[model samples]
Target: MKLKQITEVRYITRDWDRSTVKRVVKKLTNGKFVRKNSGPNTFYYNVPDIEYALDNLNVQFGEPATKGHYRTSQGDAAYYIWVVSGWKFKLSAMDMKLEVWPSGDISDKHNHFRDRYDR
Candidate 1:
C-alpha cells in the first residue's frame, strides 16, 4: 500500500487527521512495521509488515493494564482503536468481558474476551 492509501483508510475508519496519520506512519516505519520502497514517483509500504506492526502496537499499547469487564465509553473507544489497529476479534460492544494476566501464560483460556485479555 502507498502512504496516501494508508492515510486515507485511517482517516475514514478512525477519523484521524492527515498529519496524525503521517506521524503514526513514521513511528510505524521507525518501529519496523512497514518497509519503505521509494520509486521514481511513488512509494509503497509493505502491507503484511504494517498489519503485523499494527497488531503488536495495539496489543502492547491499546490494551488496558487494568483487569475485568470494560463497559464505559472510554473503554469502547479503546477497543475500537484496538480493532482499527488490526486486532482480529469479534466483539459487538465494549461490555465484552476481559481478563488480565501479568504472567506469560497467554492461552485460549485467556481469550481476548475473557479473563486474560491483557498482558
Candidate 2:
C-alpha cells in the first residue's frame, strides 16, 4: 500500500490537514502516526523507525532513546522537528494512543515519538 495515502492514522487536532498527515505518513513506516490533542501537535510515530529517523533526522536517535537524553532534528516536509524525547520516556507502539499517563516513572522515558507536524 502507498504510505502517502493511509487511513489508519488518526489525528484529533484541527491543524492536521489530510495532505499534511499524508505527507508525514509517506515518510514513516509501521503504519500508525498519531497526532496528539496538546503539546505542539507532535506527531507520534513508530519507534521501530527510530533508526531511519535518527540517521535521517540529522541526529543520533537510538542513543537518546536508550540513554534518556532528549534529541531533535529539523525535517524537510509536513514536519518541523523530528524528535526522540529521550527525557524520561519509553517506547509505545500501541494499536491506539494511550490517553492516560500510564505511570509516573520518570526514568521510564515516557516520551518516545518522532516528529512535530508542520503547521
Candidate 3:
C-alpha cells in the first residue's frame, strides 16, 4: 500500500501520529524491512514487510500503555495475535470475556456493546 494509506491506517488503528508513522516507515525502508516500490504517483510498501517490521518493533521497543478506555500498541498486537489464533476478547460490565472459535471474527460489535454498557 501507499505510504499515505499506511500512515492513515496506523493512525486510526494504533493511534500513532503522522510523524511516528513516517518515522517507522523510514526505519523499515532504511533497515530493509520493507521493499519500497515507486510508482508514477506514489510509493508503495509491501504489506507483509510492514507487518513484520511493526511486529518486530513492538517486540523490541515495547508498546506504550495508557489509562482506561484507550487502545495501545500492545493491546493491538495482542488482539492481532488473538485473532490469528482464532480467539476473541470481550470486555463486559462485570467481567472480561474470551472466546475461541474455528473462524475468528474481529468486529466492533463488542466495542459498541462495551461503550453502551459502560455508560
Q: Considering every candidate listed, which one attains the maximal lDDT?
A: 1
Off by over 4 Å in 2: 1-18, 28-31, 35-40, 59-119
Collision pairs in model 3 = none
Give candidate 3 regions above 4 Å deviation: 1-14, 29-55, 61-119
Which candidate would rank higher by lDDT, 1 or 2? 1
Worst 10 residues of 2 by lDDT: 93-102
Q: What digit string (tens of lDDT, one per residue) describes model 3 on residues 1-119?
A: 32222333333543343344345545533332222443332223333343444444344334522212434554532222112222221111111222212222345554565668778
Q: Which segments of candidate 1 are over 4 A away from where they belong?
A: 1-14, 31-44, 47-55, 60-119
TM-scores of the candidates in the order shown: 0.23, 0.26, 0.22
lDDT of 1 at 4: 28
**lDDT scores for all predictions?**
0.35, 0.33, 0.33
Candidate 2 whole-model C-alpha lDDT, 0 to 1: 0.33
